[model samples]
Target: MKIATYNVNGVNGRLPVLLRWLAEAQPDVVCLQELKAPDDKFPEQAIREAGYQAIWHGQKSWNGVAILSRIGAIHETMRGLPDDPTDQQSRYIEAAVNGILIAALYLPNGNPKPGPKFDYKLRWFDRLIDHAETLATSGLPAILAGDFNVVPTERDVYKPERWMDDALFAPEARAAYFRLLEQGWTDALRTCHPTETIYTFWDYFRNAYGRNAGLRLDHILLSPALAERLKEAQVDAQVRGWEKTSDHAPVWVRLRN
Candidate 1:
């Protein structure tokens, strides 16, 4: 089975690009982030016509997540992260599809750091860490896939010096990511292609994509059981060059069924 994750940026605005990619890639399971639309505004009909069934949690103009499955029924398990009653952002959704538990998430960007937004980002990371620990021991094949909004390490970014102070590359953020990995989740892409300069997101400004100036922000982490089945992992970097495409390209993993 092929599982993929992409930050569509805006589902409706980029439906064409998305649909075209779906036809070309044909992943069995897909996790999408940054819908940037209200629940009623999601293009359910269009997506359905593309040969997939989906469940999405959408908010107005920002922060949404969804899971699409073409291989089997998607049984939704959760819509939002637990232990955050006051937090209303539509950043998380979980479902069971094709015998694997999938969690799709859109971690906060937290730009212009050293402020409230950055604080929220760290707090959210803490919450995710707490939950990931439980998932690690659930004994089910699972994947945590989405735009993590993190650079993770120097090798994960194009220019480490230029991003040292950025929220995505901050020491605290990177440390949190490492701590999460300690919970027994494998970073599929990195595990598959360690030492390679792989990237999934490129900024639109300064001809970043043309220059290969990018960051590996989107990720698919596999639990031990799922990691054992990992056969291949790659980034569809060319997708970032498509007209009116998102800053993020699609990243996928092929698992032995």
Candidate 2:
């Protein structure tokens, strides 16, 4: 089965392109981040017409997540990260598709370091770490996939020096990401192509896409059971060049069932 993740940027604006990719890639399960639409605006009929059923957690204009499954599967859309008493972002959703438990996430951007937003980013990562631990103990094959908004290494970005102060490449952000990986989860892209400069997201400004300047912010982290069956992993870079495309492309993995 193939499972993929994409940050469509905005559900309504990118609907056509997303549907095109869904038709072409044909992943059994697709997780999305940054839907940037309200719950009532998710276009459920459009997705269903494209042959996929979806469950989404949405908020207005900022963050949202969804899971699309080809075959009917057990799905759960949780409200917020555990242990956050006041957190109210629609950034996570989990579901069971063909016996695999999966979560789609959109970690906060938290730009302009040394500020409250950056602090929130770290706190959110901490929450994710705690959630990951529980998933680890669940003993079922599970995957955490989405636009993490993080760049784990210099190789994961276009220019190390250029991105130092950016939220995605900050040492603190990278360190937290590493901690998550240490909790027995495998970064599927690196597992399959560790040495390659595999990137899943490119900025829309400064001709970034045309120049091929990008980052591997989108990812699929799998539990041991799922990692053991991992057969292939890749980014569908061509999708970035599609008409009215999102700045981010789809990253996916194929695994033996």
Candidate topping TM-score = 1
Where does model 1 exceed 4 Å of error? none
Q: Write the per-residue lDDT of candidate 1 for residues 1-257, one digit (tens) a residue.
A: 99999999999999999999999999999999999999999999999999999999999999999999999899999988889899999999999998899999999988889999999999999999898888899888999999999999899999899998799999999999999899999999999999999999999999999999999999999997788999999999989999999999999999998
- Per-residue lDDT tens digits for candidate 2, residues 1-257, read 99999999998999999999999999999999999999999999999999999999999998999999997764684656888778888998898888899899999998988899999999999999999988877788999999999999999999889998899999999999999888889999999997998889888899888888998899899997678999999999999989889989999999997
What's model 2's overall lDDT?
0.91
In model 1, which range of ten residues has the least summed lDDT?
A: 131-140
Off by over 4 Å in 2: none
Error of 1 at 232 (Å): 0.3
* Candidate 1 accuracy as TM-score: 0.99
Superposition TM-score, candidate 2 onto the true structure: 0.98
Q: What is the lDDT of residue 63 in candidate 2?
A: 96
lDDT of every predicted structure (CA atoms)? 0.95, 0.91
Q: If scored against the real structure, what TM-score would every candidate get?
A: 0.99, 0.98
